[model samples]
Target chain A: MPTAPAGTLYRGREGMWSWVAHRVTGVSIFFFLLVHVLDTSLVRVSPEAYNAVIGTYQTPIMGLGEAGLVAAIVFHAFNGLRIALVDFWSEGARYQRVMLWVVLGLLVVTMAGFLPRHLMNVFGAE
Target chain B: MTAVLENSTDTSGSESQAGAVSSFQVTLKIRRYNPEVASEPYWEEHTVTAHGTDRVLDALHKIKWELDGSLTFRRSCAHGVCGSDAMRINGRNRLACKTLLKDINPDKPITVEAIKGLPVLKDLVVDMEPFFASYREIMPFLITSGNEPSRENIQSQADRDRFDDTTKCILCAACTSSCPVFWTDGQYFGPAAIVNAHRFIFDSRDQGGTQRLEVLNDKEGVWRCRTTFNCTEACPRGIEVTKAIQEVKRAMITRAF
Candidate 1:
């Protein structure tokens, strides 16, 4: 192993950055899904255990965490589709940077539609 | 920042023609390392006057010839054909011979360092064995299994055009070293290998598609490409590297069930 990375940092283009985001979001979503499955499975033990776990997830802080998780999932999903296009579509390679922009556009639209309503449901409700 | 070291030449009294440009001081910060001299690499700075038409390679030549006796870098053709002088210039993989000093903004000190994802032997030179090993793994030469041709190998221009883009590879290791995947784990087959494989695999005159595809279908093969375009962007020869890797992946899928 080389001790020093004396070279300057590589400035990768949008493709590299998007892949990085996709990997990070994917891992985050995986861990969140693991917790979700475990907490939801508490229902098998007892309704009280299930309610106790679910109640902690209803607070304001948990609401914000949920929002971030949603954002991650949305980005991962849309970026995965873009990756699929880069794989299967004939012109995908030539237009990959453009497709990344398209994925970001779709994410903004989807998030705009979902965030406001979901936030109201979390904060506006009693 | 270091003080001005030396200037190339005084041009104040020279003849001035139409649209003539003047020389300006360009500072270069190069990463220097030698295993025998020091255990750690250090940034050595030098400033030299250069015209807008000069290249980064020309500045380096000035430094090596006049300033330092030990400044080391590899080059042969110096005209971008030999592909020996690829380095990280201002955080980008580029050929020093091809990058003009003026285009990269000489106001700020331009940094030159060895390309990443390979073992640096000394200043601006890395051991290219690992790079060529992966190239050799794919069996880059044409493989024809049938009897020897009585006449010259027959091929149409259209057949030649199919793999013409990859033939421009000078095996510079620029694309392979720019790869983020190759940086993390050196086992990945990398874009260069796949691009070379795409060359012979798609050639109508070659009969090595199956063998090359099998070599690239390993766990660390073409499947590991995450579609990052670093290789394509880093190619000095303008090869569509990511597209070549994608084509190889598609071919692999078409091969298997």
Candidate 2:
């Protein structure tokens, strides 16, 4: 085998960066889904047990973590839609850079709307 | 004719611009590597006077012929048909013979390097054995059953047009090397190999579609493609490479159903 340099850092454009972000967000969502499923399944045991477990999620740290999860979900969903459009639409490849900016813009707008309300719930005294 | 030439030259003596082509200095920052001499690759810059219409290959040729005798690169047709001069120009994969000096911002220093994800053999030459190996694995040729046709294999215009775009491929590694998946993972079949598979898979006369689909069903085969559009952007032949790969994936899914 001819030995050559390995792991040369490739500088890719918006499409490549979108691919990397998609994969990263996908893996994070998968792990988060696993824990979510396990926690949601606890409702089968008793109502109080499920309520107690759900109450723990109201903490400020969990609020911030949930915000991160929401960001991941938003990015994954929007980017996945962009990938699908690029795959199916004939002219999608030509307008991909434009689509990436649109996805980013939508993500920022949606996160801005959700974060403040979610944080208020976490830090507010009830 | 001599009198006519003298008259024309005298008539336009101050403003004659018939065959006068302007040339400007352009710097080519080429990546150089020699395993026998140095363990690592290094940058070498050469400034050459070239016309605006000159291709990047012409600049390299000028540098080799005038400045340095040892500056090496590969070329055959000096046109884009041979697919021998595919390299990274200004951080993008393009054919040196097709990319003109002025098209890629010649005002700044132009960067010339070998295609990514391939082992560099020398300056601007990469080992193509691995790339060809993947091409061969996809069974690129037409595989028909039964006896050979007596005269010619007849097909309708629509049938021939089905796989026409992929036939334009010159086996250039530009699309494959530009793929981020192929850069990170060497085992992936890459877009070019899958595009070749798509050519035969969608062929109306080919009977090897099932076998090719089975070959690409592996983990490192067509499934590894992330549809990043890099391959489509890098293809010198302008083939819709990502769409062809997607067609193969769709074919596989249809087969499963």
Give the Cα lDDT of each candidate.
Answer: 0.89, 0.86
Deviating ranges (above 4 Å) for candidate 1: A1-6, B1-15
The sequence of per-residue lDDT tens digits that candidate 2 reaches over residues A18-107 is 988998999999999998998899999888888999988878899889999999999999998998887667667667789999999999
Lowest-lDDT window of 10 residues in candidate 1 chain B?
B1-10
Top candidate, metric lDDT: 1
Overall local distance difference test of candidate 1: 0.89
Q: Over 4 Å off in model 2, which ranges?
A: A3-11, A27-68, A84-102, A119-126, B1-14
Q: Report DockQ per prediction, comma-separated.
A: 0.68, 0.32
lDDT of 1 by residue, B44-138 (tens): 99998787778999999999988996999999998999989999888888999999999999999999999888889899999888888999999
Cα deviation at B81, candidate 1, in Å, is: 0.5
True contacts kept of 1: 0.67
